[model samples]
Target: ASAFYPAALGQTTLEQWHDLFASNAQAPFFLSQHLAPLLKANQGCIINIIDALAEQANPDFIPYSMAKTALRTLTTALAKALAPEVRVNGISPGAMLWPDGEHQLTEQQKQKILQQIPLQRVGTEWDIARTLYFLVEEAPYITGQDIAVDGGRSLNSVQLHAP
Candidate 1:
C-alpha cells in the first residue's frame, strides 16, 4: 500500500530520480534483516505489492519498471526458499486507486490510463483486494506465484505506453 514518486518519464523524471540512483538501494537490505523475525513469529508469508511497470515499461517509466522488476525477482526467490515455513508472493496492481488528493487527477488523465487498459476502465481497489484474498485464503498450495490485478491490461501491447 505504498506509492512511489512521479514515474511519468513525461520529461520530468530524470530531475525527480537523480538522487535515487546515487542513493544506495538500501531498503531491501534492511528488510532482509527482518526476515528471521517474521519467520520466527510464524508469520512466514510476505506479500509484495509490485507495480504495473513490472510487466510493461511505460513510455513514462523506465526506472520504475527496472526497480519493480528487481522486486518481482525477489518475490520469486524468497518464495522458493521460504516454503513450508514462509510464503512469499506478489500482486501487481494497476489503476486500483487514483492518486487522489496527493496527485491532481483529471478526467483526461483517467481516460489516458484507461486508454491503455484493454478493459477500457480503471480497476477499483476491491479488484486488487479480492485477488489478494484468493492468494491468501484460497491458495495455500499456490506459492511463489504473482497474480496481476490489472484488468487484463498487461496483455495488450497497444494498450500500454512504451518507451
Candidate 2:
C-alpha cells in the first residue's frame, strides 16, 4: 500500500494522530490480513511503501515518523506470519519528492538536505519504483525486509562538531 497520513506533533490534533496511525500502520495490517486468503491462493506478495524517517528520530514529524516506524515493524512481523506462500516486504524512500505548498523548503534548505546524502543528490521515483519491481517480481527468497531506497542519506554519520 502506498499511502501516508503525515502530521507534526504540536500542530496536529489527537484525532489527526490517530488517523495517521490508522492510515499508515493499521490500514496496511488490516488490508493485508483481509486479503491474505486471496494473495495466498494466487501466491502473491505485498509491498508496503514506507519512509526513511521511519528508522530515525524526527521530532519535527513525530506522528509521521512513528506511524512509518510501526509500518516497518508490521512489514517484518507480517512477513514471518505469511511466509512460504505470500511474501511481504517494504521499501523506504528518501528525498524522492520535494515538499509542496506550505511545507516547501527554500533553495538553501534543499541544498543542505542534499549535501547530507552520500550520493550528493536526491533520489528519483524510478529508483524507488525499480526497487519495488525487484522485490515484487525478481526476488523470490526475500521476505520480511524493508529496503531503503535512499541515496545513502540514512548512512550519514553523526557529527558532534562540524568540519
Candidate 3:
C-alpha cells in the first residue's frame, strides 16, 4: 500500500511517521520476506510502485517522502537479496494522477506541474502498466533498477517545488 500523508517536518508526529513507514516500506518488506520462498520457487518478480519524488527531499510531505525513500532503498536491498531467483525492481511515477481531498490542486498548480514535464502532460496508468509489462516479461537481465515513468518529469528537479 502506498501512503501520501502530507505534513511538514515540524507538524508531523512520530505516529504519522511510523504509520507512513508501515504502509509504504514495512508492509512490502515483510510481505516479500513471507513470499520469498514461493517467489524463488516460481521465479516470480517484485515490482514496487514508488513515487518519482522518492529521492528528493519533500519538506511539505516529510513522513510520506521519508517512507517512500526508505522503500526505494528497500527495493535495492531486496533486489540484491533475492537475486538469481526472483527479480525485484521499482517504478517511480510522477504526476500520474491528481491528489484528492486535502491535497487537491488548483488548475494553476496543475498547469505548473504539467509545464515541468518534458512531455507537457500527466502520465496515464497505461504508461506504468507497459513499463511493468516490459520489466516482468522482457527485461530478464534487469534488476535493482528504478524506471521513472514520469514523461520525463524526473529529468527536471523543479516540478516538485511548484509554488
Candidate 4:
C-alpha cells in the first residue's frame, strides 16, 4: 500500500509526511521483517515496488520523494540482512498510471510526461507485472539491485509538477 500526494515543503503537513513514511517506508520494512523467516524457509525472494523518481529530489513532491528514497534504502538493507536464503530486490517504475482525482494531470501535462519517455508512452500495468514475474521466476542470481522499468523516462531529469 502506497500513497502519493503532490506537495512542496511548506505546503506539506506533518501528518502527510508521516503518512507517506508509513506507507512507503515503515510498512515495507515491518512486512518484510515479518515475512523473512517464511521466505528464507521457502528460499523465496522479496521484490519491492519503488518509483523511478526516488533517485531525484522533486521539489513538488518533497515528502513523497523522501519516503520512496527510504524504501529504496530499505530494499538494499533488507537484501543484506536476509541474504543467502531470501533474495531481495526492487523495481523502480515510471509513469505507469495517470494520476486521478485531485492529482489528475491536464491533457497538456499528460502529453508533456509522455514526451519525456524515450518510448513516448505510458506503461501498462502488465509491464510491471511482467517485471515482477521475471524477478520471481527468471532472476536467480540477481539480488540487492533495482531494475528501472521506466521506458527510459529516468534517463532525463525533467519533471512535471502540478501547478
Candidate achieving the largest TM-score: 4
Q: Supply the TM-score for candidate 2.
A: 0.89
lDDT of 4 at 102: 82
Model 2 spans with C-alpha error above 4 angstroms: 1-6, 157-163
Q: Which candidate comes out best when scored by lDDT? A: 4
Please give, for residues 4-83, the per-residue lDDT of candidate 1 as tens digits.
65456556556445433222123542474477477736755667777776787576666666667777787788777667
The order of the candidates by lDDT, greatest first, is 4, 3, 2, 1
> How big is the positional error of residue 63 in model 2, measured in Å on the Cα after superposition?
1.2
- Per-model RMSD to reference: 5.2, 3.6, 4.4, 5.3
List the global CA lDDT of all models.
0.69, 0.86, 0.88, 0.90
Better of 1 and 2 by lDDT: 2
RMSD of 1: 5.2
TM-score per prediction, in order, is 0.73, 0.89, 0.91, 0.92
The candidate 3 region of ten consecutive residues with least summed lDDT is: 153-162
Q: How accurate is candidate 3 locally (lDDT)?
A: 0.88
How high is the lDDT of residue 159 in model 2?
54
lDDT score for candidate 2 against the true structure: 0.86
Stretches of candidate 3 exceeding 4 Å from the true structure: 158-163
How well does candidate 1 match the true structure in TM-score terms? 0.73
Model 4 lDDT per residue over 80-144, tens place: 99989989999999998887888789999999989899998899899999999999999999899
Lowest lDDT 10-residue stretch of candidate 4: 152-161
Which digits, one per residue and each the tens of the lDDT, describe model 3 over residues 1-163? 5667777968988888888889999999999999999999999999998898787787888788877888889899999999999999999999887878887899999999998999988988899999999999999999999999999877776546558
